[model samples]
Target: MVIRISKGSILILCLVLTNCKDSNKKLKETTVVSNIEKTLNFNLESAIADCQTQLERAVPKLTDLTKHPRFIEKEDTDWHQVPNDKLMWTSGFYPGILWYAYDVTGDNKWKKEAIKRTEVFEDFKNITEHHDIGFMMFPAYGNGFKIGDKKEYKDILLTSANSLATRFNPNVGTIKSWSNKMHPRWKQHITIIDNMLNLELLFWSAKNGGNPVHYDMAVKHAETTMNNHFREDLTSWHVIEYDSINGKVLNRHTKQGFADDSRWSRGQAWGVYGYTMVYKETKDKKFLDFAKKLADKYISLLPEDMIPAWDFDVQSDPKEEKDASAAAVVASALIDLSSFVESKEEQVKYLNAGIKMLNSLSSKKYSGVGKSDAFLLHSTGAKSLGWEIDVALIYADYYYIEALSRLKKLEKK
Candidate 1:
């Protein structure tokens, strides 16, 4: 006898098979994601050891405390030193790296070297020709005071904040980033996104016994930058020229990006890190929201490895250089920003992004082990000017160590 099946039974059988296939596909996707996360789980202790080894190699090569490593040229084994006497903006990062090493390893030698290197910048407080005094002083003295609680470091930081405040034009509501003579085309008061990082010194000083005007200056500068420096998409312009007398934006342009309409990777990183720091100091929700927007935009533009090109809009050539310094800076900032957000989803997203970037930097592909004296390699600085491209930068090492230290602390929490 032939058994007859209803059309309804056949439809039910088909639906069950379809459901099983969908479930299998989802299970495979989840397994892939789990494998990626596990692979990206970095070894913090080993990463820190690599940094210590690099620092050990670097210290013996420092012939003068006044001369600090800025960047290494391509195929060069030795770091090119720049004199602190010139008040170079990159000076503090070397001492800051030493301080980070000291923090991570509890090594007295790194502390001694950090103090020695940092003391060279004591005279920089009096040089207020530009707005980079914070960058020159904070990493050395700010981290020094935080770690050692030295009164001298606090006094130096306060003095440096005062000098930075002098560059803030009340009318323009922002700090002048460069001197007119330096950029004759920008005849008016000009501010760059990098200036946002300098405001942290002012915010810290105001809370730690400096004048309240420093705080006000920082807030105003951040507000003005938030208003004028960002496009609708939250990508930042490298420079904003303002009429010093009228407090009006005169021009929105680029100094280091591919074009005036393009986004500079380091500049965008500065905005992300700076706004996160500003929110931390002020506890303002607006700054925090703005920082999240900046961070999301930056993260969305990154390649699969979580590293960005020197500029986002540069023609996508196979040889396009990556900015590990920018990645390091944003990684450190994202870790800090992760802790500040209230949403668990957002916190996990940011923390995971930070970790992924750190993992990429710590891998053999980026680590400077046995190849250079720096902790990481392939950082681009001002590619438009044929400056330091795909080389080791001191700030990259500083922030990479900072991010690792932060992750270690966060793990404990």
Candidate 2:
């Protein structure tokens, strides 16, 4: 067939060809970027060694082992240690970091320091006014037992789990995260998403010869939080208030996010970590499914660097500050979650996502290294409360080291 094309039609064909060429270039560029991300080198041993060096410098500065180091403010050169008499929720993290260091290096000196720091929380097992006994004891005594299998450490962990159980009201179906005195505005029995992490102690203790009731309480709390603490999209609220008498959700709010409905980065991390752990302990498919949903939502919303801002819904500004602590928690949790998933595809995706996060954390941009004694930098702790913004938090260091240790074990396997 002989056909004559008009000038306009010829122009249209040329434009279409140009657009196709542009699209092909973009596709090639994207593929290269994806390949680069997949092949990014993450030296787990070097990262752990860097952490050990940081800890070696930090331990000497902590002259009083009784007072745990908490954070280093952006403007300060020294750490703000938790007061000796005060029962801080973060008291166990310092010891936990030491324990992880010992695990990674198998150095007797790290073990000795870890034991000294772990013993400081032995009396914390009896603290019953709050739900943080898990935070205070598990990382200290729980890790101690896990490493050395000491009878004393096991006993302390059991006692700590029991104390945590006392805060669980049968009527509320969740443990009280804060006492009335702790937050006067939260007169109703308040439970924070962070409470999910404390359930691990109960689950472990129940399996290790404590009251089986501890297991039931942990499951009940997980179920209640699973039902009430999450939005339809699966992002979590930092706090949920409940009616103490009848087990009803009274209000959903946030203490550390941009607003009441905003997704706090650390709170979501807690959900991912907590649900993953709950599924591991219970072997319930429902919990595992919920954990995947939580992790998926979190992974979906992370920034390009794999680190998240303090609040996911916060105004998008380059200087808005990132939460390395949240990244660390999610990294550790994702590594554990990777093992639980049945599909190999899902396993590799989660595991690679976790390693990518750890790689970002290990970089000099987020790593404390020579800048501070803490292991990681730029962690936001309760930014809405104007506290610990852009600081190196003890918990961030704890989880970073924990993630590294977990990754090391996976490499061996």
Off by over 4 Å in 2: 1-38
Q: Write the per-residue lDDT of candidate 2 for residues 1-413, one digit (tens) a residue.
A: 99999999999999999999998865654443244345877777789899889988888888796688989998665688877553589999888888899999998898898888888667788989888888888888888888756667777788888889889999989999988787887888999999999999999999999999999999999999998999999999988999999988888998889999898999999999999999999999999999999999999999889999999987377788899999999999998887789876787788889989998999989988888888899999988899999999999999999998887676555
What's the lDDT for residue 337 in model 2? 88
* Model 1 segments more than 4 A misplaced: 1-39
Least well predicted 10-residue stretch by lDDT in candidate 2: 29-38
TM-score of 2: 0.90
lDDT of each: 0.88, 0.87
The residue pairs that clash in candidate 1, if any, are none
Candidate 1 per-residue lDDT, tens place, 1-413, comes to 99999999999999999999998865654443344347787777888999999878878998787588999886986789987764488999998888888888899999998888889788898768999888888899999998755667888888889889889899999999999998898999999999999999999989999999899999999999999999999999999999999999999898888888899999999999999999999999999999999999999999999889999987276589999999999999998998899876787788889989999999888999999888988999988988898999989988999998887666645
